[model samples]
Target: MFEQEYESFWKAQVRNASGQRLEMLQRDLTGTKKLLEAVLLPVLGSLDDLILEYEMLSVSGMKIYAVVCLPRLRTVFEEDSFVTHAEKITRDRFSFERVRARSVAILGYTYFPYSRDELEKKASFCQRNLFELIGRVGNVEGTGMNQLPVYEREVLRFAVYNRKPFQLKDVCEWLQLRKEACRQVVRELEFKGLVNAVGGSATRCHKFMISEKAVALLHRS
Candidate 1:
């Protein structure tokens, strides 16, 4: 029942939108979350079997991984560097750098036997299988060179016009590039102060809009 609910919640939360508006996005996320709780939890019976880790596999196929301990496990990595032999597994399995520094927590929960040992094992599972899972889940990575033409300009435009929070995936969908390509553009935009990512890669999806500076520069130009 909980598993089913979680699945419903997950699906409901994936509110796809375009044109990059903040209020609309907020509402979208809110709706998505509500949908998750209402539909997903009751259906899934448990959302607590796996840990979520985010990896930034660059356009060059270089990966940066971060483990996320959800709910109360938030601070697991705060005091600790959160590196382990599993870190090696992450690197080897994913073929990318394990960038624990920028990891962010997406959604995470533990299974019924929610013991510390179970949770740690789940964490270890994420530390190892995150990259692989991402691949299995249809999240593709592309190179900077493959990014949409005029992407930096588009990012600047989106930021200036939207004046709200956004995720890297939002930019990717807006620009029609993969997350890796989107990150490349976002890096350039950040350097130029055209846009910024509020949290680390774990919450890479959580973005606040910042385009006033870029808008001013565009007017000047």
Candidate 2:
């Protein structure tokens, strides 16, 4: 469901120790994705919904260009643009300027410390929201999303991670599903009351979000 083919991280890594060693720092990728998919997508849509910053990789102070996945907002933005993003965690991994060049909006930086206390201390508004989001990923309480089919779970996870309105085109591209098939999935979610369509009746029904009922239940989860 993570869609490795859609993930630039796995597409062209050397796979030897030199490349694989960086796996220890996967939180760089995961955390970035979480922030964008959850906190930043809404503002980003208003800025540049047509394109995205996608995945980034900086290793040992060297800028590494990765294979680009075109025409979508990718989850990861691996940059060390500020003290908050990488300098706080480690040095010589990425560049703030290079990452900015690829970005639509300049979101805040995030530092994921191994210590919960340290993390809780420096969590700016963005980081605090992201921290709560991380909690929701692996259910704090089993809310039955586990019972869903794999594809349904993927879309639901996207909705939950987004915590905001989204479009079928975005999810379809992000999840690598055919358009019609994704519509069917959304239809199922609407029936289950996990999702619902949103828009004026005069306008086309193009926007959707996690249902408020489901959101209320999930917050407690």
Candidate 3:
């Protein structure tokens, strides 16, 4: 519910890359390559990151796009070769190791014939990676707030899974705990910087976002 603007931004980014859309992204998103790694590393394991990037880039006749500039780096880094590789990779069912071995450069090209179906398949694969990557970034845990209670951890997990803010009632319903108990748990969690609460009442919408500090903590763990 609260991420309507973000969803709109994501859709606009995926619109056919031309005119104002292309120009808007180039001006705003240029030189923003590192953002992709930052957004991807949290959700995707190292191998997944490599495959996701390789699948999302464009080469020659085929092109690539993402929900945001961050995930689009794979496309930008790769050129026509990505298109070629996409064709081969889709048809041959290559091993992950082979894909990794062959597609080492930021963008490398391999030759394969293209079909309309391949284009759609490539786009679908890339889109799934983008959405998964975004979800990982949004719910990332920071370093300082690692010591949450089991119930509180569940609450945060539920919030992120739903992709919206959590209210007291929602948390209570999820954990099957009393409202007061959930509130106390949430309060303790907030004090530790593991979760956030906004608004004034039990019905107040609370967005349980993870902080960078918590992400660092998770990394250490």
Q: Report the number of the highest-TM-score candidate.
A: 3
Any idea what lDDT model 1 has?
Answer: 0.41
On residues 129-199, what C-alpha lDDT tens digit does candidate 1 reach at each position?
32122112211122121132467766655554454577887788789988888888787777776665576
The alpha-carbon lDDT assigned to residue 98 of candidate 2 equals 47
Better of 1 and 3 by TM-score: 3
- Let me know the TM-score candidate 3 reaches against the reference structure: 0.41
Candidate 3 lDDT by residue in tens digits, 42-91: 33322222221223333332334322312222222222234344555654
- Whose TM-score is higher: candidate 1's or candidate 2's? 2
List per-candidate RMSD values in Å.
19.0, 15.0, 12.3
Least accurate 10 contiguous residues by lDDT in model 2: 66-75
Per-residue lDDT, model 1, residue 217, is: 39
- Which rank order by TM-score, best down to worst? 3, 2, 1
The digit string of per-residue lDDT tens for model 2 on 129-164 reads 543453345243354455667677677666766666
Off by over 4 Å in 3: 1-38, 41-84, 88-146, 201-210
